[model samples]
Target: MKLAVVGGGSTYTPELIDGFARLRDELPLSEIALVDPDERRLGLLAGMATRMLARAGHPARVTTATRAEEGVEGAGAVLLQLRVGGQAARDVDETLPLECGCVGQETTGAGGLAKALRTVPLVLDIAETVRRLAPDAWIVDFTNPVGIVTKALLDAGHRAIGLCNVAIGFQRRFAAALGVAPERVSLGHVGLNHLTWERAVYLDGEDVLPGVLADHAEEIAADLSMPGWLLRRLGSVPSYYLRYFYLHDAVVEEQRTKPSRAAEVAAMESALLEMYGDPSVDTKPELLEKRGGAFYSEAAVALVASLVGDRGDVQVVNARNGGTLPFLDDDAVIEVPARVDARGATPLPVDPVEPLYRGLIAHVSAYESLALDAAIQGGEERVRDALLAHPLIGQAGPADELARRLVDANRSFLPWAVSR
Candidate 1:
C-alpha cells in the first residue's frame, strides 16, 4: 500500500517509520511518500526512513515530495501532521495566553483556538486536493487541535479520522499496571480530542478502572497534575490537558516560570535532525523518546492497518458524533472508540454520561463549533464569540483581550488576522 505522511520532515516521522518496519506484516507498505515543504528536514527524514526499512529487510520504497498534491496523489492513505506556523509560531501560542491570566497551552484555551484558526484552513485545502487526487484515500489527521481539524474535513465531505496518542498512552500505562498486554486493555475514553476522560479501563472485559484508581491514584494524579481527591470525586481520569481547566490559575502561574514547551521541542528537534543525518544511526534514538508523542508509531500503524488492510478493529479515534452523544450535533466530531475499516470509523455507543463531564463537554463542544467557524469563516466577531465560549475565557473582558492578543501574535499566519 502507498502511504503519504504530510509532515514527513517532522522528528516524529522516524518513530512512525520504525513502526512501519516492525509491523510490516500488518500492512504491506509498498512505497511511502514523505511530503513536506521543508526540503532539508524531509531529506534527512527520508534517508533515515530508508535506512530503518533496509535494516528490517522491508522493501518499501521511500520517496519525497514538497507539495501535498505531488505526494498524496494515488496514495491509499494520507496522514496529516504538518505544523502551520512551525515551532516559532508555537512559541507564541504557548506564551501569549499566560499574559492574559489563562493557561498558555497549545491544544486548549486561547492557544488551542489560535492553532485551530491557523490550521483548519490549511487542512481543509489539503483535504480538498486529496479529494481531487485520491478521492477514496483516507485522511488520517495526526495534527494538533484534531477535533476541530477533523470536523473541518468531515464538514467539507472528506473522508477523515483524527488520531491522538492520549488513549494509547493511557492504555499502555494501564496495561503495565495490570501486567497485561496492551491489546488486552480497553479504555472508555470519551470527550473531544485533547479533552477526554477515562471513565473506565477494561481488562478481560471487566472494568478495572476503579481498582486502578484506588491503587494508583497518587501516581495517576501526579501525572495529570490534578489532586487525587478530585480524581476520586469524578470517578474518572481526565486527560492531562484538563490541567489547564481544573487548575487554571495555578497552571498559568507555573507556565510563567518555565520555558515554553515549543522552545524545548525546538532544541530537541535540532538534536534529532542531527542524529537523523548520521549514516550509522539505523534505529530510532533514545532521545526521540524525550521528544514526546509516546507510542505514536504503534497507534499510527494500527490505525493504518485497520483503514487500509480492512482489519475492522476497535480503536479510539475522532469521528462525527452521529448521535454517540445526543447533546452534540450529529455532524460534530468527537473523540471516542470506534470500529474502523475501509468503510470508515463508526463511533461506538457511550454509556450515560455524568452531568459534571457532560456539561463541560457541551460547553467546549459549543466553543469548538464557534472556533471552527472562526477558523473557516474568519472574522473578528467569530473570533471574539469563540473566545467567549471557551471555558478558560468565559468572561467578555478577558475574552476580548485574548482575542486581540491572539490575532496580533498570529497575524502572519491568519489572513483575516492581518486583513483587518
Candidate 2:
C-alpha cells in the first residue's frame, strides 16, 4: 500500500516514522511518499526515514516528491498535516488576537478561525488532486482545526476522517497511571477536536475514572491547567485546550507575558531540522518529545491501519455526528469514539451529555459551520459572521476588529483577503 504524507517535512514526521518502525506490522506499507513544497526539509526527511526504516529492517521503500499531485498519484491513503504558513504564520495566529485582549492561540478563537481559512482551501485543492488521481484514497486529516478541515473535505464529497492525538495521549497517561498497557485503557472521549473531555476510562471493561481521578487528581489537574478541586467537582477530564475557553481572560493575560507557542516551536524546529540533517541519527530525538503532539505516531498508524486494512476497530476520532448528539446537525463533524472501517467512521453512541456541555457543543458547531462558509466562499461579511458566532469572540466590537486583523495579517495565504 502507498501512504502519502502531505506535510511529510514537518518535524513531527520523524516521530511518526518512529511509530511506523515500532509498529511496522500493523499496516502493509509498500511505499511511503513524503510530499512537501520545502525541498531541503523534504530531502532531509526522506533520508531520515530511510535510515529509520533500515534500522527497523522494514522492506518499505521511502520516496520523496515536491508536489502533492505527484506523490499522491497511487496512494491508498493520504495524511494531511500541512501548516499553511509554517511557524511564521502560526506566530501571527498565536499573537494577533492578544492585541484585542482575546485568547491568542492557534486552533481556537480568531487565531484558529484564521488557520481554518488558510488551510481548508489548500487542503481542498489537494483533495481535488487526489480525487483526480487516486479517487479511492482515504484522507486522514491531522491538520489543526481538524473538525473544520474534515467537514470541508466531507462537504466536498471526499472520503475523510479527522484524527487527533489528544484521546491517545490521555489513554496512554491513564494506562501508565493504572500500570496497564495503553490499549487496555479505553476512553469515553467525547466532543470536537481539541474541545473534548474524558468522561470515563475503562479498564478490563470497568469504568475506573473515579478512582483515577481520586488518586491522581492533582497530577491530572495540573496537566489540564485546572485545579484538582475542579476536577473532583466535574468528575471528568477536560482536554488542555479547554483551558483557553474556560479561562479566557486568565489565559490571555498569561499569554501576554510569554513568547507565542509558534516562536517556541520555531526554535525547536530549527534544532530538530539540524538533527534530521545528521545521517547518523536514525531514531527520533528526545527533543522532539518537547515539540509536543505526543502519541501522534500511534494514533496516525492505528487509524491508517484501520482505514486501509479495514480492521473495523473502535478508535476515538473526528467524524460526522450522524445523530450521536441530538443537538448537533447530522452533517456536523464531531470528535468522538467511532467504529472505523474501509467505508468510513460511524460515531458510537454517547451517553447523554449534560446541557452545559451540549449547549457549548451546539454553540461551537454553529461557529464552525459559519467558519467553514467563510473559509470556502470567502467574503468580509462571511468572516464577520464566523467571528461573531465564535464563543470566544461573540460580541460585535471584538469580533469585527479581530476579523479585520485576521484577514489583514493572513492576506498572503488567503486569496480572498488579497483579492478584496
Taking all chains together, each candidate's TM-score versus the true structure is 0.98, 0.99
lDDT of 1 by residue, 353-413 (tens): 8888899999999999999999988887889999999999898988999888888888888
How big is the positional error of residue 250 in model 1, measured in Å on the Cα after superposition? 0.7
The local lDDT score (0 to 100) that residue 154 gets in candidate 1 is 87
Highest TM-score: give the candidate number: 2
Candidate 2 local lDDT, residue 374: 96
TM-score of 2: 0.99
Candidate 2 ranges beyond 4 A from true positions = none
Which stretch of 10 consecutive residues in model 2 shows the poorest summed lDDT? 411-420
